[model samples]
Each structure stands twice: as structure tokens, then as C-alpha cells.
Target chain A: MALLEVMNVGIAFGGLQAVSQLDIKLEKGHLYGLIGPNGAGKTTVFNLLTGVYRPTEGDIILDEKNITGKSPAKINQAGIARTFQNIRLFGEMSVLDNVKIGLHNQIKYSAFTGIFRLPGFKEKEQEMDYKALKLLKIFDLDTVAQSPASSLPYGKQRKLEIARALATNPKLLLLDEPAAGMNPSESEELMNTIKFVQKEFDVAILLIEHDMNFVMGICEHIYVLEYGRIIAQGNGESIRNNPRVIAAYLGGD
Target chain B: MNAIKNLKPSTCNNLINYGMVLVFYIVVQILVNAGVLNNSMQGMLVPICTYVVLAVSLNLTVGILGELSLGHAGFMSVGAFSGAIFWMISGSQMSPVVGFTLAIMIGGIFAGIFGALIGIPVLRLRGDYLAIVTLAFGEIIKNLLNAIYVGWDSNGFHFSMKDVSALGLDESGEVIVNGAIGITGMPKASTFTAGTILVIITLFVILNLITSRAGRAIMSIRDNRIAAEATGINITKYKLMAFIISASFAGMAGVLYALNFSTLAAKKFDYNTSILVLVFVVLGGIGNIRGSIIAATVLYVLPELLRELQDYRMLIYAVVLIAMMIFNQSPQVLAWRSNFVSKISRSGIAARFIKQKRQSEEV
Candidate 1:
């Protein structure tokens, strides 16, 4: 059975159908891409999948457990984590602290332990610090770990968001426009990093990216979306040649 | 060696603060007991302590945790009435220490339960709507308190305030509170020493909580709810935790206020008190614990300090608040202050000594 299955998911806002009868399935370690032009409902789909917006009608099954309309925190606790299209690091906090927050669910210390400084609390805190440092090192952000997240350059902020999501130890990861503001070289680097994350973390990835080169280079399978509908789903080369995909991107018959 | 050197300044500051608070309280209490200070001055101290505790604790919710709640006064009212009633019934039978302890605990518990109830409904509403709902809830509580009637024992359980006061003291010799007229005769259980101790304890707990992981979770929710949620932090649960804790502290402060004054008035825990506390939090650095405590003390004492101006006291306060808002909000004012300080230090010969010391330490 697939690790995640979305069946006939539909969501609407007022009269606008933001997403309509969308379906997706992913195996444990697949590198999948959801691509489309602006307002193609790619992010809307991400929002639906991550439980940020509940589908008006449909079922989202993860590991044989149905998780429809669960709170976003519940979805994350169930081992699905995501980054925003616009980097949403806790800007006032230090870079390492932002990543540390992602580890919140895993920590075993109670509020009582936290306030009174219990022995187990100290050990758990040390463990969290070590884990946060490890994740920071993976993103090559250890040097600026103590600096406030807002003070980081835009590229580094994006990297920090990814590192923070990874710190949650999610079984499935979703990246929304991960290369939204990157130059070619930076986009190239990010493409390799995404692939590396998929391989090293042994986690399935569902990403929405408009950067064609980055999407085309790293994605094993690509789904093209237009006007809240999936127009085509196939390997990258097939997507590149599809007439509908071409029409969607070029706006022609 | 490097870690110790780095930690030295903060550690020294902490020690100095503790010593100063201890010395100040000791001297103040001695002066008060010696009758050098008037009853009005003593009365002013109660409000100052209560406001300081309320402002500092409310900062946990508003400034650091970043949720706007105006129902804080409601929680304070709950605590005050509950604690005052407890003291009235059992205070004369028990030692002052035990009575004070019971009062604070009752106040905290009452406030905490009400806080959780109010938070469950309102915490789901974020930003402006949340503030409005909480403010409405506070008004509702005030109206509810005004309407509720607990019959007086005398004259076959009379409903009127006149009849309630006629019920006379319990065996404890304290007058039972008459509904909206408030707790008439509470024991003057809180001393300056007790208030000072409570302040110290509160500062310790708040400081420790804010610097801890749970505190950081609360702060992260304030900073970015979506990011915090994606990280598996239950935003509502943490926000409620902040709310309950903030309310509990405010409640404790209310109990302290009642005990200090030997009376409780419903009008005292009105909307204006909540706004006053908010001003204290804002005028001080919002998230800074020390700043809140300092702001509460300064603002509470400012009115009294200008009491010689009599009727103009309130006018002066309004002017000062407006001026402060204008100056604090302007970036140019901050820049000018920084520039002026820099210029002064640069012109002083002591600046060279300090710069040399800093360089030596860096090396």
C-alpha cells in the first residue's frame, strides 16, 4: 500500500473551487513534484494535504489511518511536516531556537519539569540542544545558529526553514516553492539538497515548485496542475512534452 | 575560563538585584512600622505591589506570548471575592501566615479555573477578535457580579446591600462581603515584607518560565502560529497555558491587594485597572520582565508623587502618557537618544578606559 493516499479531495472557498477532486498517492521514499503556473491550486493542494485547509469532500489516508480535517499540529504529530512558500521562521528567535521548536513534540519533559528544573528535564533539554545542533550542521547553518532568523540572508532563511521542518523527524516532507527566490546556482544547490534529503532521511517528498529546472531535475514524477485540476501526471520528460502542460504554461490552444 | 568570563556580568547583576530588593524592603518595612509613613502612603504601596505583579504577569500573555486578553480584571475579581470570603470565614481562627497562604491559593485556583473556561472559548479567536471577545467577557463578568444576589442572614435573608451589612461579623470578627458593595472587612493580612517576598517569588517563576522550553514554545506561537503548528506545537494548548498562568498571577495579586487593604471593592477591579496594567506593560519594554516591574512601580508611584498638584494629578498623568507614547513610537527620538549618549561617552576620558578593557577581554 502507498504511504499516503489522497482520494477525490475537493475544497472550495465561497464560489471559487480552490481545489477540485484532486487525488495523489506516494510510496515511502518517492521524490514527487506538484507543478503549475500561478493560481493553479498547487499551494491549495499542499494546504489540503498538510491539513491547513480541510477538503470539502474526500479522504486523506496516511499509513492506513484516515486523517481528514485533523488540526495541522495533529497532522505534524502524525509524522507529516511542511515548510511555507514564504519562509515562516520564528523571525525574532535565534536560528537554532527556530529549529528547536520543531523538536517540541518529541520532548518528554512536562510543564512541571520545565518550571522546577527536574533532572529528566535537564537531560531532555541537553538532548534537544544536541539534536538542534545536528540539524543546523546538516543545513550548514551552524555558524549562524545564535543569530536571529530575520538577520539571516533570504537564501539562508529558506535553508533554515527546511532544517526546522526536518528536525520534526517527519516521515513525509512537503516543500512549498522551496526555490522561489533563488538564482540558478542556488537553485541547483537546493535541487541537490532536496534529493539528498529524500535519500538520507528515507522520507517521501511532495514539493510545489515553479522553478522548472529545479523541479524537472530532481522530481521522479511530476503532476501538472491548472485551474484547480490536475491536467497531467507522469515522468518529467513526459510532462515536458505534453500538449496540455505546454498550453497551461504558454496560455495557448 | 571563557564560559565563566562570559557569565560573570549576568550573575553579578542577578546577585545585585536580589540584595537591593532585600535591603529596600527591610528599610521600607522598618519605616512603616515606626509610623514615619502615613496610612495613605501605606495604602499606595498596596496598589503599587498589586499593579506590579499584575503588569509583570500579564506580560506573559500580552508581551512575550503575544495574545491580547482584556479579561484579566475578571480573573482578578474572581480571586478577590473568593480570597476575601475565605479570609472572612477562617482568618480570625488561624494565624496571619496561614490565612495569607489560603487567600493566595484560593485566589490563584479561582482565577485559573475561570481563565481556562474563558480561554477555551476565546483562545481560538486570534488577534483583534480575541481582544474584543475577552473585553466583552470582562464586561459580562462585571455585570453578572452586579446582578447576583446572595441573601444576608439577618432579617430573614434580605437581598439589599443595607441588610447585608446589617448581618454583622462572623465569629472571625470580619464583615462578610455584600455582593456588589464588595468585601467590607477583610483582614489586613499582607505586610510590606510579604508583598516584597511575593514579588521576588513571582519574578523568579516568570523569569525561569520565559527562559525555559515551554516558555519558548509560547513565544514561538506568538512569533508565528503556522510555523509553530507545523513543528507539532499545539498552539491553543500553549496559549491557554499562558492565559491561565497570567490570570492566576493576576488573581494572586488581587488577593494580595485585598489582604493589604482589609477591604475589596468591585469597582476597583474594573476595565480601567486592566487598561492601566496594559499601559505599564507597554511603557516598559513589552517582553522584558524587569522592564514591566520597573514600569509598574514608576507609573503607580508617579500619581502619588504628583499628588501635591491635587486635581491636576490625572491631567498630568494623561499628558505624560501621551508624551511617552509620542516619544517612544518615534524612531528619530530613539536615534537621537543613542547619538547623544554616544557623544557624551566618546567625549569622556573614562570611555577610553572602558574601550581598552573591552579590547583586552576580547583578546
Candidate 2:
């Protein structure tokens, strides 16, 4: 069975259909890519999958459980985490504290315990600190951990977003335009980091990237979307040669 | 082992903080009782203690947790009335210590329930709309209390404050709340020690809350709600928790205020008090507990100190606030001040003495 199955999902806002009749299945441990031209409903699919917007039709099943219409927090708690297309770090907070928020759901303490500094509260807090630090170290952010998140360079900020999402211990990770505004060298490095995360962390990844070369290099499978519909799906070579994908890219169909 | 080493300083800091609080409380008690301070000074000190608690606790909702709640006075009123009523019914029979404890707890409970009720619906709204709604709720509660009659007596229609001294006694004779005139002839219950101890406890709770994981979570939400939500932090749950906690603290402050005054006036907890508390949070650095305490004390005392200035008191206040705004807003001014301070410190004879001492010790 697929790890995440979307069977005929549809969503509409008012009179306009943002997404219509979309079906996609992601198997466990695979790096998948979703790519399309501008205004192709690529982000709408990500939103629908991550529970940012409830699909008007069809089912979203993770593993074997139907997870349609769940709140974003619940969906994230159920082991799915996603990054925004735009960088959305807690800009005012220290870099380490930014990742610490992802560890909140796993921390075991009530507000009373926190308020009073109950014995167990200290222990759990130390554990969360250690975990947040470990994640920061993995992303090479440990040196800048004390700096405010807004002070970080653009590339580091993007990496920090991924580290924060991973801190949630997600089963599936989604990257929305992870390489939207990176130099060619930075994009190359990010592609390797994405592969490394999938391999080392053993988490499934689904990325939406407008960078064709980056996506084609890292993704094991690719799905092409156009105007709220999937025009093609296959391995990298197959997708690269598909006539419909080529026509869609050439603005012919 | 590494974690243990890193954790040592924080633990030591916690112990030191508690010790300091105890020492401070003892010193304040001694000063108040030794005839070194007058009754008017004590009166001013009592509200400072309560407002310190109120301002720091309210920061949990307003500054750190990022919710705009203007209904803090509503919770204070609830606590004040509930505490007053509790004391009126049971105070004379019980020891003052027990009566005070029970009254404060009763007040906190009623205020907490009301806080949760108001938070549930209003927390759904964001920013200025939430502020306006809570402000309206506070006024509505105040007006409602003013309109209702609690009982009927020889003096005609009895309200909350009427006959307060006569209702608590047994079949012999007693009073609970005086009708409409407000609670009268009640024994003064708040002492310097009680107020100081409560303030210490409040400071302890607020300090711990800000440093803990949950405290950090609330702050993170305040800093960036979208990022916090994306990380699986429940925005609504944390916001409501802040509101309820802040309201409960405000309630506790109300109880202490009532005990200090030995009465409750419907007019005592108006919108002006709420604005005053908000000013305390802002003038103090937002999310800084120590700042809140200092700000509350200074702001509360400043008005009394400036009373001699009479008509110019408000003008002076406006000028000072405008000056603070200007000082805070101008980056160049801040930079110049810092540079000046650094240059003086580095060039002074004190710096040379310290440097020589360090060099001699190393030799």
C-alpha cells in the first residue's frame, strides 16, 4: 500500500476551481516531485495534502487512515510536516528556539508544571533542548544558534525551515518551492541535502520545485501538473520524454 | 553528563532567585512594621504589590503570548466581588489567615471561569477586534453590576455593597455586603507580610513560566503565529491558556486589592485601571518579567509623587511618555548613547584599575 494516497481530490473557492479531480499516490521512502508552469495548481495540491485547505471531494488516506478535513496541527501531529513556499521563520526568535517549537507537541509538561518548575519539567526541557540542538547541528546552524532567525543569510534560513520541520519527527516531509530563490550552486547543495535527509532520516519526501534540473536530479519519481490536472507521471527519463509534458511546457496544450 | 554540566547554572540561578525573594519580603515587612513607613506609604505600597503581580501576569497574555485582552478588569472585578462576598460570609468566624486564603482562592476560581468563557469566543478574533470585544465585555459587566439589585432591606433596594457588615453574623447579628453603598465596616485583612508573600509567589510563577518550554512556546507564537502553527503548535490552545492564566492572576490581584481596602467599589475597576496596567506592560519591556515589576512600581508611585505638581501632573506625564517614545524610536540616539557609555567605561581610571588587577593576578 502507498504511504499517502490521494484518490480523486477536488477543491473550489467560490465559483473558481483551484484543484479538480487529482489523484496521486506516494509510496514509502521515495523522493517524489511535483512540477508545473505558473498557475498550474501545484501549490493547491500541497495545501490540500497538508490540510491547509479541505478538499471539496475525494479522500486523503495516510497509510490506511482517512485524514480528510483534519486541521493542519492535527495533520502535522499525525506525522506529516511541510515548509512554506515563502520563508516563514519565527524571525524575532533565536535560531535554536525556532526549531524548539517543533518539539512542543512531544514535550511532556502542563503550563502549571512550567509555571512552578516542577521536577519533571526541567528534565523534559533539557531533552527538548538537546534534540533541538542536534537538529540544528545537522543543518550546520549550531554556530548561529544564538542569532535571531532573521539575521541568518537566505540559504541558511531555508535550511533552518527544513530542520524545524524534521524536528517534528514527521513520517512524510513536503517541501514547497524549496529552491525558489537560490543560486545554481546553492540549488545543487540543497538537492544533495534533500537526498541526504530522505536517506539518513528515513523520511519520505515530496517536493514542489520550479527548478527542473534540481527536481529531475533528486526525485525518484515525477508528476507533471497543468491547470489543476496531472498531465503525466513516471520516472525522470520517462517524464522528460513525455509528449504531453513537453507540449504543456511549450504552451501548446 | 554533558547535559548535567550545562544545566547546573540554571538550577543555581533558580535557588538564588527564590532566596532573593524571601530576603526581599523580610526586609519589606521589617520596614513597614518598624514605624519607618507611614500608613499612606503602606497604602501606596499595597497596590504596587498587587499591580506588580497583575502587570507581570497580564504580560503572559498581552506581550509574550500576543493576545490583546482588555477585559482584565472584568476578571479583577469578579475576584474582588467574590472575595469580598466570601469574606463577608465567613471572615469574622475564621482566623484572618484562613479567611484571606479562602477569599483569594474563591476570587481566583470565579475569575478563571469567566476568563475561560470570554477567551473561548474572543480568542477566535484577531488583533484590534479582539481588543475592542474584550473592552466592551468589561464595560458591559461593570454596567450590569451597577444595574442589578442584590437584595431588599430597611434601606430599600440593596445592592452588592449595602449592609456588608451585617450579613455574615449568625442569628445574633451580622452583615455581608452593604446595599448599593458598597461593602462597609469590614475588618482590614491584608497586611504587609501577606501582600509581600503573595507578590513573591507571583514573581516566582511568572519567572518560571517564561523560562519553561510552554513559556517559550507561547512566546514563539507571539513572535510568529504562522511559523508556530506550521510546527504543530496549537495557536488557539496556547492563546486561551495565556488568557486564562493572566485572568486568574488579575483575579488574585483583585482579591488582594479588596483585602487591602476592606471594600469593593463598582467604580474601582474601570477601563482606566486596565489601560494603566497595559501601560505598565508596554513601558516595561514586553516579555520581560523584571521590567514589568519595575515599571508597575514606578508608574504607580509616580502619580502619587507628582500630586504636588497638581494640574501639571498630566502634562508632565504626557511629556515624559513622548520623550520615551522619541528616545526609543531614534536608532541614532540609542547608538550614540551606547557608544558614549562604552567610550567612558573604556577610558576611565576604573577600567585601568580593573585591568591592572587582572594582570597582577595572571602574573
Candidate 3:
């Protein structure tokens, strides 16, 4: 069984169907790419999966559990975590603190314990600091851990978001335009980070990217989306040769 | 031990806040002992403490929680009445320490309950809508308290809203709360020491919560609600928690303020009082805890000190408010201030002065 199975999921906003009949199966530890044109409902799909919007129809099962229509927080706790397309970071927080926020549910202490600064609270916080620092170190963000999230360069901010997402210990990770606004070199580095994250974290990765080179270079299987529907689904070789994929990107004559 | 070493910066910062409060307490003690403080100055101490507590607690909502609450005075009013009522009923029966402690706790708990009640619905609304609803809630609380009349008699506690006569109290009964007039003849158990102690406690709870997991969650929501939610944080739980904690502390401040006076009026905790606390928060630099403490103390005490200014006092206050606003917020001023601070630190002026003092002492 796949780690994630979006079985015929669809969402409509009144007169408009934002996304429809989206079926994708991602096995554990595999890297998948979701490629599409502008306004092709890529982010809307992510929002539906993360329960930002309850699907008007269909079930989203993660690790054999049906998690459709659950709140974003609950969906995350159910082992699916996602980064936003527009880099929605906790900008005012320190980079280290941002990742620690990701570890919020994994380690728990009561509010009373926190306010009182009990021994248990101290121990838990130390543990969290250790864990958060370890995660930051992986992305080479440990040096600037004390710096505010917004102060980091754009490329590093994107990396920090991914690191924050991975801190949730999810069974599946979704990256929405993770390479957006990055130069070619930064995109190349991001591709390596995504590949590393899949291998080390052992979570299935589903990412949406507009950069064809970045997508084809890293993704084992790719899904091409246009007009809120998948135009093609296959490995990079098959996806590149498919006439429909070419026409969607280059525009039909 | 190594983990502790790693925690030095934040721990040291917290220590500095506590130390500053302790130093202030000691200096004030010295001044009072030396007879340097006047009668009026001494009298202003407890009120200053009360405002300090109010400012800090309100910061937890307005600054850290990232919500504008115009009903903080409402919570304070609830606490004051509830605490005063408890004291009137049981204070004479117990030791002063025990009675005062219980009174404030009752006040805080009552206010916290009200916070939970108001926060549940009010928190669903964000930004300006939240502010307006909170303002309305504050007015509602004040008006409701004004109409309430409660007395204790052989028939136990009696409550009536129409008037005191409708309470049907026995001849032996004494009114604890009279409509409009509010609570009177209450014990003035609040002292400067108690007020300072409450300030310290407020600082402890708030500062500790800020660095904790719960604090992180609350701050994340403030920084970015969507990101926080995506990170598996229960937005409502943390938001409500911060709001209640803030309300509870505001209530405690009210209790402290009420006990210091012989008479307590619900009207005192009006919208203006809420705005005054907010002014402290804003001028202090929102989300800056130490700044709030300093701002509250200086701003609250400034008017008292300026009594001699007479006609010029109000004009002077407006100027000072603008000055503080620019000093705290203006981009050019902020850059200059940061540069000044960095230059001072890099020049090692304080460090050199400390070294010289140590050498002279050793000699």
C-alpha cells in the first residue's frame, strides 16, 4: 500500500471547480513531482490535502487512514506536513524557534509546567532544543539559528521552511513551489536538499515545481496538471516525450 | 551542564529582568528609609505597581498574542469586585497574609473564567473586529456590575439587580456590594511590598511562559497563523490560553488596586483605563517585556511628579508621548539607537569601568 493515496479527490468553490478527480499514489520514501501551469489549481490541491479546505468530494488517505476534511493541525498530526507556496514562515521567530514550533506536538508539557519552569519542563525544553538544533544543522542553518526567520536570505528561508516541515516527523511531506524565486544554482541546491530529505527522513515527498530542469532532474515520477486536471503522469522520460505535456507548457498551436 | 551553557543568553536575559526589578525595589526601600520620598510619592507607589502589573499582563495579549483587547479593564473590574467581595466576607476571620492571598486568587480565577467565556467567541474574530467586540464586552461588564447589588444576612448571600431594597436583607445584614455606589468600607490590605511581590510574580509567569513550548506555539500564531496551524499547533488552544492568562493577571492587578483603597468603583475600570494600559504597551514597544515594565512605571509616575507643572503639565505630557513614540518607532531613530548601543558595547566603556572598580576594591 502507498504511503499516501488521494482517491478521486475534488473541490469546488461555488460556480468554479478548483480541483477535480485528483488521484495520486505516493509510496513511502519516493520523490514525486507535481508540475503545472499558472492557476492550474496546484496550491488548491495542497490546501485540500492539508484540510485548509474540506474537499467538496472524495477521500484523502494517508498511511491507510482516511484523513479527508480534517483540520490542518489534525492532518499534520496524522503524519502529513506541508510548506506553503508563498513561503509562509513564522517570520518574527528565530530560525531555531520556528523549527521548534514544528516539534510542538511531538514533545508535550502542560502549560502549568511551562509557566512554573518545572524540572520536567526544563528537561523537555532541553530535549527540544537538541532536536531543533539537530534539524537546523542538517540544512546548515545552525549558524544563523538565532537570527530571525525573515532576516535569512530568500533561498535559506525556503530551506528553513522545508526543515520546519520535516521536524513534524511526517509520513509524507509536501513542498509547494519550494524552488520558487530561486536562481538556477539555488534551485540545484534545493533539488539536492529535497532528495536528501526523502532519503534521510524516510518520508514520501510530493513537490510542485515550475522549473522543468529541477523537476526532471530529481523526480522519479511526475504528474502534469492543467485546467485542474492531470494531463500526464509518468517518469521524467515519458512525461517529457508526451505531446500533451509539451503543448501544456508551450501552448497548443 | 553543557545544555545549561547553551541556554545562557535567554537565561541571562531573564535574570536581568528579575535583577532590574530587585534593584528598583532595593533603591526605593533605601529612599524611603532615608526619608527622601514625600508622603504623596509614597502613596503613589502601590498605584504605580498596579499599573505596572496591568501593563505587563495586557502586553501578553496585545504584544505576544497579537490581539488588541479593549476589555482588559473589564477583566480587572471583575477581579476587583470578586476579590473585594471575598475579602469583605472572610478577611477578618483569617490572618492578613492568608486573607489577602485568597482574595487575589479568587479575583484572578473569576477573571480567568470570564476570559474563557469571552475568548471562546471573541477569538474567532480577528484584528479590528476583535478589538471592537472586546470594547463592547468591557462596557457590558461595567454596566452589569453597576446594576448588581449583593448583601450577606442570616438568609445567606442575597443578590438583586433592581435596587438594594429588593435584596430583602435581614437587619443584621451588611451590604457588600451596593448598586452604582460599588463596594465600600473594605479593608485596605494592599501594601507597596505586596504590590511589588505581585509584579515579580507577573514577570515570572509571563517571562517563563514566553520561552516555553506553549509560548512558542502562541508566538508562532502571532507571527503566522497559517504556518503555525500547518506545523500542527492548535491555534485556538494557544490563543485562548494566552488570553486567559492575560485576563487572570489583569484581574490580580485589579485586586491589588482595589485592596489599596477603602472604596472600589466599577466605573474606575473604564475604557480609558484600558486605553491607558494599551498606551503603555505601544509606547514601550509591543512584544518587549522589559520595555513595558519601564514604560508603565515611568508613564504612571510621570503625571504624579508633574503636579507642580500645573497648566504646562498636559502640554508637557503630549510632547513626552510623541518623543517616546519617535524614540521607540521611528526608523532613523531606531537605526541611530542601535548604532549607539553597538558603539557603547564595542568601546567596552562599561566593561572598563567595572574592571577599574574591581582593581580599586582589591587594592
Candidate 4:
């Protein structure tokens, strides 16, 4: 069974269809790439899978459980965690605290225990601190753990976002343009980190990237979208040779 | 001193806030014992403590939760009335300590209920829409309380919205609440010591909460609702939790405020009161608990302390307000303040003291 299965999912906004007839099957512990032109509904697909938007048609199943139309939090609980294209980090909080927020559901303590500083609260908090630091250490962000999320440089912020997502302990991790604003070297470094995360965390990764070299270098399989529809799906070499993929990017002659 | 300095940043921060309150309490006690405080000065103490608690709780909603609530006073009114009614009903039956504690709890619980009710509907609305709705809710509460009339006798409580005659209470029935007149002849149970203790308790709960799992969740929502939701944080749950906790504290403060005066009026908990608390939160620096305590105390005392200046007092107060705003909000001022604080902590008297202590420890 696939780790994530999107069975003919589609979402329409009134007269316009944002995403239509989208189908994806992600196997466990694999790195997949999603590429598309601007406004090809790549983020819309992410939103649908994460339950930020309920699909107008079709179902989404994660780990063999049908999770379509569930709330974002519930979808996350069902093991689908995603990073935003725009890097929606908790800016004012500490880098360590941001990861701890991801561990919110992982450890349980009531507001009552918190206010009174009960024994369980202290014990759970220490465990959370340890867990959060370990996750931060993975991204080499432990040194700046006390620094605010916004204060970190752009590349570090992206890494922090990924670390935060991984803290949720998901089966399928979605990355929306993980290398959007990075230089080549930075993107290369991010590519390595993403690969490490895939192997180390042992979670399937479905990433949307525009950098062809980065995608071709890391992804085992790639899907090309144009006009909210998958134009082609194949290995990197096959995708590169496909004339339709060329037409969508370089325009047809 | 070294031990305090070596503590975690959050723990050190908590100690500073708690210590500041304790020191202030002790100094005031000394002044009172020395007969340095006038009757008017003494009278202002409990109210100052009340406003401090109000400011801290409001900061939880406005600062930590990142929501502008214009109906904080509405919750306070609910608590004040509910707690006052409890005291009236249980009159002289319980000891003061137990009765007062129960009244505070009752006040907090009632206010918390109102907070949850308002939060469920209004929380769905954001920004100015939320503010406007909360403002309307505050006005509604005040108006509703104005029309309510309640009295009690051996047969139980009688209630009416019309005239007092419509209540149809027996001749022995005593009116606890008389429409716009509100609660009258209520015993004064609030003292400065009690007020200070309540302030300490408020700080403990709020500070502890900020470092807790739930507090992190609430703060994450405040920072980025989209990210928080993506991380599986139950948005509504954390939002309502912050709102209710804030309301409950405000309620307890309200009960303390009401019990200090024999005659308590619903109009006392008006929009102006809510705005007054908001001013303290804003001036204190949002999400800065220590700043809230100082701002609340200083701002509340400034006008009274300047009373001898006559007409110039208002002018001075306005200037002080502007000064505080700049001090709190201006980028240049903030940078300078941080620099100044770092300098003091690193190389000033605090540094020298730590150095001396370290040298002695080595010996």
C-alpha cells in the first residue's frame, strides 16, 4: 500500500477550477518531486492534501486510511505534515520553541498542570525540551535555539521550518518549494539535508521544486503539472525527454 | 545572586517579576508603618493592585494571544456580580479567608464561562471585526445588568427586569441587586495585602503558562495561525483557552475591586475600563509580562502622585503617556534600551557583584 494516495482529487473555485483530476501515489521512504509552471495549482494540491482546502471531488488516503475533508489538525494527526511555500514560521518565538510547537500533540499536559506547575508538567516539559533540541540539532540549529525564528538567516529559517514539520512525526512530509530563494550552493546544501531527512527520519517526502537540477539530482520520480493536470509522470531522465514537459516550460514551437 | 544569574533565562525572568512585586509590597508596608502614606495614598493601594492584575490578564489576551478584546470589562462585570451575589447569599456564614477565596473562585469561573461563550462566536471573526463585536458585547452586558433586578428571602431568590415591584418579593425579602443601582451595601473584604497576594498568584499562573506546552501552542497561533494549524495545533481550543484564562483573571480582579467598595455598580465595568486596561498592556509592551506589571503600577499612580501640581498634572500625565509610547514602540529607543540593559548586566554593578561573589567562592 502507498504511504499517501490522492485518488483523482479536484478542487474548483466557482467558475474557475484551481486544481482538477490530480492523482498521486507516494510509497514509503521515497523522495518524489512535483514540478509545474507558475499558478499550476502546486500549492493548491498541497493545501488539499493537508486539508487546508477540502477537495470538491475525490478522496485522499494516508497510510491506507481515508482522510479526505478532515481538518488540517486531524490530517496532521493522521500523519501528513507539510511546509508552506511562503515559509510560515512562528516568527516571534525561539527556534527551539517553534519545534516544540510541532511536538504539541506528541506530549500531553493540561493547562491546569501548566498553571500550577504540577509534577507531570515539569516532567513533560523536560522531555519536550530534550526532544525539541534533538530535532533542532539535526538541522544544526541547536546553537541558535534560543534565537527568535525570524532572526535566523533565510536558509536557516527554511531548515527550521523543515525541522518543525519533522517534529510532528509524520509518515508523509510535503515541502512546497523548499529551495525557492536559495542560491545554487545553498540549494545544493538544502538538497543534501532533504535527502538526509528522508533517510534519517525514514519518511516519504513529496517536494515541489522549480530547480530542475535539484529535482533531477535527488528525486527518484517526478510529476509535471500544467493547467492543474499532471502532464507527465516518470523518472528524471524520462521526464526530461518528454516533449510535453518541454512545451509546458519552454513553450511549444 | 550568582545562583539567580545562572538560572535559565525564563526562570530568571520569572524571578525578577515576582521579586519586583514582593519588593514593592515590602516597601509600601514599610511606608505605611512609618506613617508616610496619607489616607488617600493608602486607599489607592488596593486599586493599583487590581489594575495590575487587570493589565497582566489583558496582556495574555491582547499580547500573548494576539487578539484585541474590547469586552474584557464584560467578563469582569459577570464575575463581579456573580461573586458579589455569592457573598450576599452566604453572608456571615463563613470565615473571611474561606469566603473571600470562594468568592474569587466563583468570580473567575463565572467570568471564564462568559469568556468561552463570547470566544466561541467572536473568535471566528478577526482583526477589527473582532474588536467591534467585543465592544458590542461589553455594551450588551452593561445594558443587560442595568435592567436586571434580583432579591432574596427564605423562599429563595426573586428576579425581574421590569421595576422592583415586578420582583414580587415578600416583605422580608432584601434586594441584593436593584436594576441600575447594582449591588449595594456589600461588605468590604478587599485589603492591600490580599490584593498583593492575588497579584502574585496572577503572575505565577501567567508566567508558568507562558513556558508550558499549552502556552507555546497559544503563542504559536499568535505568531502564525497557518503554521500552528499545519503543525496540528487545535486552533479553537488554544484560542479559547487563552481567552478564558485571561477572562477568569480579570474576573478575580473584578471581584477584588468590587469587594473593596460597599456600593458596586455595573456601569463601573464599562468600555472605558476595558480601554484603560488595554492602555496598560500596550504601554507595557505586548507579550512582556514584567513590563505590564510596571506599566500598570506606574501609570495608575502617576495621576494621583501628581495631584499637587494642580492643572499641570494633566499636562504632565499626557507628556508621560507620550514618553512611554515612544520608549516602548520607537525602534531607536528599543535598540538603545537593549544596549543599555546589556551594558549593565555585563560590566556594571551587577557584573562587579557577580565577579566578587565568584572570587569569594574560589577562595
Tens-digit per-residue lDDT, B1-363, candidate 2? 233233333444455556655676677678877988776776787788789888988888888887777877878888887787778767646998988988888888888888999889999898999999999988876766554434334444334433343333334443444444556666778876777777787777766776777777788788877677768888888887788878888888888888887567767788998888888887775665655776788778877878889999988887766665455435686578658865865797545655565557459
Q: Model 4 compared with the native: what TM-score?
A: 0.96
State the fraction of real interface contacts model 1 keeps.
Answer: 0.68
Q: Estimate the TM-score of every prediction.
A: 0.87, 0.88, 0.96, 0.96
Residue by residue across B1-363, what tens digits does model 3's lDDT show? 233233445755686788888898899999999999999999988988899899999999999999999999999999999999999998746999999999989999999999999999999999999999999999999999998999999889999999889999889898999999999998799998899999999999999999999999999999999989999999999999999999999999999999999999889999999999999999988988988998999898888888898999988888889998898878899889868865874576644554465457459
Residue ranges of candidate 1 with Cα displaced over 4 Å: B1-39, B147-175, B309-363
True contacts kept of each: 0.68, 0.77, 0.86, 0.89
List per-prediction Cα lDDT, in the order shown: 0.81, 0.80, 0.90, 0.90
**C-alpha lDDT of residue B307 in model 3:** 86
TM-score of chain A of each: 0.98, 0.97, 0.98, 0.98
Model 1 over residues A1-253: C-alpha lDDT tens digits? Answer: 9999999999989989988878898999999999999999988988887888989999999988899999899999898999999889899888878888888887767777777777887678768778888788777888787778998999999999999999888889999999988899988888888888899999999999988888889999998889999899999999999999999999897
**Residue range with the least summed lDDT across 10 consecutive positions in model 4 chain B:** B1-10
Q: Model 4's A-chain: what TM-score?
A: 0.98
Residue pairs clashing, model 4: none
How well is each residue in A1-253 modelled by candidate 2, as lDDT tens digits?
A: 9999999999999988888889999988889999988899998998898888999999999988888998888888888888988888888777877888888887668888888767797678778878888888777888787778988998899999999999988889999999888999989988888888898888989999988999899999999999899989999999999999999998664
